[model samples]
Target: MSLASQRAGLSRLPLRAAAFVVLTCVAILGVSGWREWAARDAVLKGAETEMANVARSLTQHAEDSLDLLDSGVVGVVSRLEMDGTGPSTIAKLGKVLEARKTAVARIHSLAIIDDQGNWLTSPGTIASTLSDDTFFRHHQLSPKRDAYVGHPVKSVLDGQSVVTLSRRFNKPDGSFGGVVLATISAGYLSHFYEQFEIGRNSSVALVHGDGLIIARNPNNERFVGRSVADAPLFRDPSLQRPSGAYRFKSPLDGAQRVSFFKRSGRYPLLVLATVDQDELLAPWRAAAISRMLYVVALVMLIAIIGAVLVRQLQRGQRMAAALVEKEAHFRLLAEGSSDMVTRIGLDERLRYVSPSSNRVVGWRPNQLIGTDALAGIHPEDRPHVQAIVDAMKRGDMDEARLTYRNVHRQKSEVWLESTMRVTRKDNGTVDGVVAISRDITEQKNLETRLETLAIEDSLTGLANRRRFDERLKEEWARAYRDRSSLGLLMIDVDHFKSYNDEYGHPAGDACLRVVAKVIAAEVQRTGDLAARYGGEEFAMLLPNTDAAGCARVGERIRSAVHDAGLVHASNPAACVTLSVGGAACRPAFERTAGTDSLVEAADQALYAAKDGGRDRLMMSGEVTTLLPKASGQ
Candidate 1:
């Protein structure tokens, strides 16, 4: 234990301590790297799972959309078969197609083609024949009644790409008659796919079983009808399941992505959801690098300060973990939301828009940022929306609920119900508005359809008796207030009962519809109302008309019905004809008379016309007397 021996030992202690610290730092770095790798792998797996879920959801949506179109086509085919392909039947079919086209925004057109590919009924007259079309040929040859979804084709009418949903119709003898086709715009599918909040360079696509890209987000018109059959995704034996995930470089975009695909159970369509490999791994990589740097810093501090900094390092780690968790939670809530979350500056510009903006208005968050918040509002609704914003700015209302029309990027109108709260500073100064908006377009459309159904006749597409009564009362009041004459014409089909017996109930319905159209045509004024009063009976109310004008309109209606030339072997005229009765009056003020008197007068005139001879018009006199026959004797 001399001084030399003691000094050597003390110097060795420092070297030994440095070696031990180096080993400890290496071990810590190894463990930290391993943990980061594991976490990164888990994040990637989670991303794949999320993509799979998105793919499944999009597949189901696409299947549902196709099924809806298929069902509508089938219904039209069934209806056409039940009622033959005569002119009247074709007219009815056209009406059905028109209604379906309006109700379904995705449906570009609903058409019926004959066996020879002639357009039997369509939204508009297009001379193009479907004889060369694959869908038509498939139905013409195949006996299967399954609806066939055709590949994308440029529509001759609008030159836009469309996929056809078609059902084959057979004749009574079970022979192929024609195909009832519904064209769905490919843009609609693209718009739907754009709603998903997949990361940057991500893709959502719908492809045919044959690998034709039917529709895709980030849609390129050139690649839509192209085939990807040779691509690894389709060619890979391991990725053939009904639903699956795979990693591949996209042939179209050349970006490497982890893609999830789902095949529709009901159709030959496949939906793909994908995320770029780099994008998906970006956050985890950044977090890993940050953790690595923090670990290195911790190691340096340990070497310098021994174990004193360990507790502080642990505390920092915990705080960092908590921040990461909070960020993840925030992203989860924000991205998963279906309702759009928005921050609007006091300048009426969009400060921040959530990913859900894509779903609600078909606009990306970036596309909306810094744009005028009220720019997309419908012109008619802008004033109201501005008023609401003004109220919030004035501090009169801290929160408001507003429903307004937002013009979608596709030029369609979407109704959004927004709940907005004014964000205020501590000093009570307005900061901005925070809002949550939900798309209510479908709900609004449903309400509109219900309202239409309530007031429209299902058979003739005219006003029903209820609607007629409502309008009659309204017009009557208006005419009374203005001291103007109101005209009423009661029309009945001649020999309708016999027509039914001879031509069957369906033909009778057809005849009645035609006669109703004729009556409707005769009363073309803005305030005129023509309605199916009852079975085989129709009524027309024309405001600001005298007895002479009423008689002239009645004559026009009778002639039009006769000119329709709807064959009626039972009637003496050898065709479908209408018997008309007319009445005109200037209603007096209270306690003078009721609308019943006008109706009774018209009824009496109608009996006189029928009694004199069918197919004629008779006018009611001023004193409720029946005047001579006007015309159509």
Candidate 2:
């Protein structure tokens, strides 16, 4: 034991000591990670279980409310319909509804409009004026024994959102008379969602089947009645899931957020939940970053100590001492890293797992180390995931990304995003991949929102021009493929200019929206499209429709507009009516005939309608001479 030997031994001691400390730290991290993971897994599992229960609770509550409303409404409407549409009937029904004010008041006003565009009974004197209103036409179109629920429309009596429910009534002897009606207020239905509790920086809203935001918590006043057509949450194909979380941009603050949706089955209601991104990732991010920082600090300290120790050591003993110390330091670093650093086998199973394994999967590193990683993937997504791995093996991709739902220890589905990079040999051959994943349900939501804004219309809530264009092209292609006719109807609100002149621009805007809704309802075929072409005008594309079908649809739209009866001093054909021009033709792709031709023909016919005295439907062949015969024919 000479001086050199002592120096070598001292250096070896430090190396062994550092290695032991690093290994101990690594084991601690692995154990801590496992423990934390198990706890989080439990919490998430409980949350999922609770969510299902909550959904059931919400469903039950909503069902009770609906049933109560239905029962009360049926009694009143049945009495009103059984009696004649006389003043006595009106007085009796009004008194009955007023007596049941507690229930009826929960909604907006309740009234009965006849099939001939006349109010049979109502809340007040305003009913007399609505006698010739547009809703009457809707009642006429609705069949006997069936109810027609109009889209959200503003009540002329009160400036509020309302859904007009009407059932056609006829004498037992088979004579057509009128309809029984009920108007549901915005406040009544919106109150249901207002009671929900989402996490902080989160929101819950109710959207219509057509993708319009009818109600929302926190900002219902601002966003309610506003259309999210331009929002990615509305238009993206991926966002169509019935109940799942994705990303969205806050309409108020424009911040990216996670959004979850549950589409209502019975009612045209859609529930959405939104949450901020950073809020969800904060804990995991902090833990991962802190661990990396610790590793960096330890590496720096070890490097400095190694340099200093080498300088102090005599030359002859340095090499042997350095080798031993380095091996120990390397081992310590490997064992001490915070992440569950492991060497995977060729079979894609866990050959090694750090103590941190328990933190990630609710199982200790030892428990999972020998198991196949594929076992953790959700059964539904497993095949696709394995396919991606296989592609990676074949050098089809340098790296791959995946987000999958996995069942945790508590049996809760957790969304996970994974990034895997394949390790390669010097010969460029495939080696096992190192995959790292983190929960990113919120991130995916934001991306989904971005995609929605690109597809939907911002106003009128009908599909935007681009979306309409795409749908039109698709419909046209289908019609051509099947050798069926495609019908195009172009509608212009007659004397809209005069309506705007007599009423304010706000009134004009309101009139247009109401008209747009009427058109939407009238064109109810699954493949039909109703879109705002531009200012005061709308377009419809009907697939598999012939000339007669297009004509009937056009007449229904014309009649509905006339029924709305929004006042206009300049129009000769009653209060604000619509003039529609339609064209139906089997498409020919090789003939170079574009959609513009149909639009042009329809527009030309519309001009003829205006020239012939507005509020009529004109087909491509008919000229202004026929407008008079078509008017109220």
Candidate 3:
């Protein structure tokens, strides 16, 4: 051999020794990595399954608490409204809230709060210490539902985290009254997570859809309420695995660890199981060193045989490298497409996120990779979106198109039209959903504007006759159902034919506009609509407003029209006055009343107003005594 060959020969002994050591280390690393991956995956799956069971168990336990609360408040409100009394109401509310304290320990107290924000009762020493609470402020304004569950908050009663469920009571007229508020404990949630059997360095966190950390186990002093929204696993663009191992510096311990993550329902929750990387590979590392020493001793006895064997292995490695390159190239193309692609699980979490997310949602690819995709939807659209998702999960609907408003980055709202279809695997299992959302706010707004223009009157800004009649029909049905009162006012400009005879039609038009404005201003209440019935006659439809309220509005309109300073000399009626006649009668929905009869009732009242000295109001019930005008006059 040449001198270089001789040097290579001398180095061959050490090189063989070193090659055995390196190969042994690589094999050990591969085996240890595989085992660590499996162990971490198992730990996450077990913990997540356990936590899900805990959530179910706690839901059952809390069910009775919620139902009891619903029953108690319903009874209390019913009695209060029926009796029209407030004396024993507060005491009854306090008793019910105190009674449930054993089941829900976090409730400081229970009380009734009116719409004006005055608490009727309080629990324990809190009543003596503080006089007012915002809990009732929010509850009174809320719609009357079974119960209003407040977001989790620190209790004023006990200084512990809890949620309050308030039930609203309505007045006899269907107006909202005060609310009965009951606070519920958060202890059940903590108890639920405790059963998960988290390892020494393992943790489970519940994050809100907005990334607010709701709760966690092995509670870190700093990470409990903080948003891990900026973490690389949450913000990076390359993460697309459903349940995979990844290395990241732990926010709590500040040590590099391998974590396996599984996301919960599109509710902004993530379950992570982590272990220190060095600790996981410790056993395999030791085994690898031991194997390298044994291989070095064997290689010394057969150097020439090892050289041929290494050359064949190198050729095989080159072939494997070429295949890996092709696979990677295709994966990049699939992930980087323009379509808004996602893989959703049966549980409604995102299993995969494509690079298209950056353009579609203003989020980097990894920002929502393992996040609950449902949480990204607008609150108003959640039910519909979840329904479709659930249907697909149950194999009901295959494709669906839904449009809903989504909040953009700068707090502006944008409407998106999402087209979603089911994705299935070759083995006939659902992989997830692939959806494309295109901005459609402009289109929806245009459609809405066109619909509004069709329904609304252009000049007077009141509902047209069509809309008014539709509303009257709706009110008629409601009044019939509740056995409540309904009133209609037919306002006719006094001697409009004579006024148009004297002044030009344009002046008559101006007078009509002014009268419409006055009539509209007088009858401004919920369920009250003023619309041009036809010609100069404007009709006001009032539901739930009794005869007294209608009379008050009628007098106000009479005064407002006279104040407008328009002149009408016909029949010596007051200057520019409207002779308004109201028919106050509860409409029957099922048993029909003739339209002519209803108009006749109002028309009779108008004649009564005209005879009772114009610029006056007349009701259907009092028309006979109010006016006895001769038909010819």
**Per-prediction TM-score:** 0.47, 0.39, 0.44
lDDT of 2 by residue, 1-633 (tens): 443345547667656655665665566666666766775555444444444444445545444544555555677657755776678877887777656654555545555556565655553733732323444666555555654445566656656666555555665565566655556665565666566564566556656667676656666556766777676666788877666555556766776765556665555566666655556546666776776677656666766675565455435355556544433543365456554455454587875565544544556766777788778888999999999888877778868888787656654565677777776765677767766655565677787877766665556676667877888788878877888788888899877777788888989888878988898897676888888888888888888888788999999989977887777777776588888888877765323565665666678878888888888998885222233232222
Each model's lDDT: 0.82, 0.66, 0.65
Pairs with backbone N, CA or C atoms under 3 Å apart (clashes), candidate 1: none
Which stretches of model 1 miss by more than 4 angstroms? 1-332, 588-591, 623-633
TM-score of 3: 0.44
- lDDT (10s digit) by residue, model 3, range 1-633: 233234334446545665875566566656756765676566555544554554444334345555666666677677767865366766765666567655555444455666665656653523432333544656556664556654455545555555456677777887777776665445544555566553455555544333445455656323444666777767766644444455688776686666565554322344555555556556656865676566555644455565666666656555544544433554476476775666676667776667766666767767887778887678988898888888887778789998887766554677778788897755666657777777677798899998888777877777888888788878877887897777778888888888888887888888889998988887667889988877788888888866787777787888899888787766465478888888765555324453344456777887899888778898786322223231111
lDDT of 1 by residue, 1-633 (tens): 333234435445545655677778888988998899899889878988999999999888888888888888888888878987899999987887888788888777778888998888753633452223888899999999998988888767666678888999999999999988887778888888877887878888889998999888886476688899898767888888798878888888888888788998889998888899998898888888888999989878777774444445555555544433433554577678889988888899997788999988999999999999999999999999899998998888999998999899875789999999998765677868888999998899999999999998889888999999899889888988898898899999988899889989988878877776777677567999888888888889989999999999999889988988888887888998888998988874322556777777898889999999979999988622332122111
Candidate number with greatest lDDT: 1
Candidate 3 or 2, higher TM-score:
3
Which regions in candidate 3 have their CA more than 4 angstroms from the true location?
A: 1-341, 345-347, 351-366, 394-397, 497-508, 567-575, 588-596, 611-613, 622-633
Q: Give me the overall lDDT of model 1.
A: 0.82
Pairs with steric clashes in candidate 3: none
